[model samples]
Target: MRVFRILAVAFAAITSLSAAPASAQFFLKPADLSGPRVTGNEPGILGQTLTGATQTELDAALVWNLRAALNVAALQCRFAPSLFTREYYNSMLEDHAEELAKAYKTLGGYFERTSENKKQGVTAFDQYGTRLYSGFSTVGGQLSFCQVASDIGKEVLFSPRGSIDRIAHERMYELRRSLLAWGDQAYRGYFALAIPRLPNFNDDCWDESEYRAKRCGDFFASNDSKSG
Candidate 1:
């Protein structure tokens, strides 16, 4: 009977352990910065043109912005070996190649239509790409940006084909918000160190080689003695 009871207890302990969730490095979920929903037509959200862009062109801009953010995260977030930023990004390139290519082509067309000539358009398009990647660069918020990008990248893998624009329109603001620096929010209690007091180092308290006991009172004097 005792043996059976012990076995039951052991099984219960094992079951409890197995049921508990595994812990990883914890970070608070960032505030919802993706403001009121829109129809993927807001060019201003991703730093694109404030005018002249049609709905399709705006959607393309959002998609390109998201791609740039993730690309930057993949390059900057490699310090955290566990993050799948690079792998997920590479997979995204393959899985959504058609949609991404379409967005890039649409953006190129917009620049060409707005520029004075083909050469100027090409130059403007190249500058836009450069600025897009540069916009996501971060030093202080690198961890937050990388973690957020990884989460978004994983979601993109499961997203429906040709719906990358929808993901961008929904999460691009949140991604931008993550670029602002934030730190641990939990309040850890203050700890005051009790540093040991040292004896006086005055010349009178020390002989050439050793402490002068007569001048220093005690080598390790009491606080009260020193005060007196």
Candidate 2:
């Protein structure tokens, strides 16, 4: 009887361990900033009138592209600084140069497309549709800054532009200079805090899925349950 009980306990433990969900892993993945790797021989100009895209559209597009590029630069800083470096941190500097180049290309493409569409009297929604898109980019930038600051105990220099593209460009320039002066550790620290943490699955009294499914309610209730 003693032997059977011991065997049953061992089996139960093994089964419980096997049923456990995998622990969450965190790491910053690099982003692609290379000029839209997909382009073709589209006509250089649309009808003689020029494209129908407006100045507002062009500005919005620029902001969209710049933010995208900045995000890519941040990822590059995380995963592949060696790819950016020429020697020591020079390669990282080069990576920033390449990121800026891509940003410019994307901006130019936006302008060209806008002009072409405007000439043909066709609306370019891609540009105009990006009016409020800067919010996400701003959040990403803030998270990136926080991650770097938390990790390296250094400040991330950012621009004060309301427009996404200009902010991205200015931020990149500032980040590049800061990186050169402070080294990669600071940026790595930023990533550590910027990335979200997973819930503790081992706590049986609290159901992670229930909390995730619930919408906004009493803040104190949510905090108490989460704490428990």
Candidate 3:
């Protein structure tokens, strides 16, 4: 009976090994840990769904919002170290606010300028604005971690060589990770909106710095002969 059980187990193991594909060997390969690619659609938004819209429409919406969300998140993460010092935090907050405001203004300009572009219109801007709001809400969510850190930091003031300091450090890292994750999700949704349609459009047509400038230029040039 013991010999029969051993044979059965060996047969099952052999069958499982034979059924496994060569591709399975590389299934757990490590990803490249380098920073995200700047030119293509950001990774986070690659396969997201926009609740009420068709895939194409959502893709267009993602182009504008995803980039903005990434920029905001990057800036916030860069500013986070300053939060440890009151004076530095105040300075960083001023700088952070200015940078964010500039990004918001730039986004607003894109929306106003591209309101009539055939590929993406005012609706894209509205969708992008909604994404910005969502990203900001996530920023607010990190405050809970900050509060915990603050509490621990205060407790450790009396006994500076205790476990409370370690706990505070762990909480800070957790807060930072949470902020980054939220930003990535927001950007992912934005990329989903843009990447599918980017190939069909010319670089001139979708210039981020000068919204719809190429389309407007092409339209005028095409109409010049008619006016003449």
Best model number under lDDT = 1
Whole-model lDDT for model 3 versus the true structure?
0.37
Ranking by TM-score: 1, 3, 2
lDDT of 3 by residue, 1-228 (tens): 334533543464456556653321211322222232222133334222333344334334333332333334334433333222232233223323544344445544555564667346457756756655464335433533333222323332222222322332233233233332122233443432221112324566666755474454554444454344
For candidate 3, report its TM-score.
0.26
Q: Estimate, for each residue in 55-164, the C-alpha lDDT of model 2 and write its tens digit.
A: 44433444343344344444434432222211212222332454445544554555556555653322343443343233223333443432332222111112121323
Tens digits of per-residue lDDT, candidate 1, 25-129, equal 335434344555555555446665525878888888888888898899889988764555776687678778999999999988888988999889889899988
Q: In model 1, what are the clashing residue pairs, if there are any?
A: none
- Which is superior by lDDT, 2 or 3? 3
User: How big is the positional error of residue 17 in model 2, measured in Å on the Cα after superposition?
Assistant: 43
Error of 3 at 221 (Å): 57
Alpha-carbon error at 10 in model 1, in Å? 32
**TM-score list, all predictions:** 0.67, 0.22, 0.26
Off by over 4 Å in 2: 1-50, 80-157, 161-228
Cα lDDT for residue 154, model 2?
13
Instruction: Report how far off residue 94 is in candidate 2 (Å).
Output: 27
Instruction: Go through the candidates in order and give the C-alpha RMSD of each one to the true structure.
Output: 18.6, 22.2, 22.2
Provide the lowest-lDDT 10-residue window in model 1. 187-196
Native-to-model Cα distance after best TM-score fit, residue 124 in candidate 2, in Å:
9.1
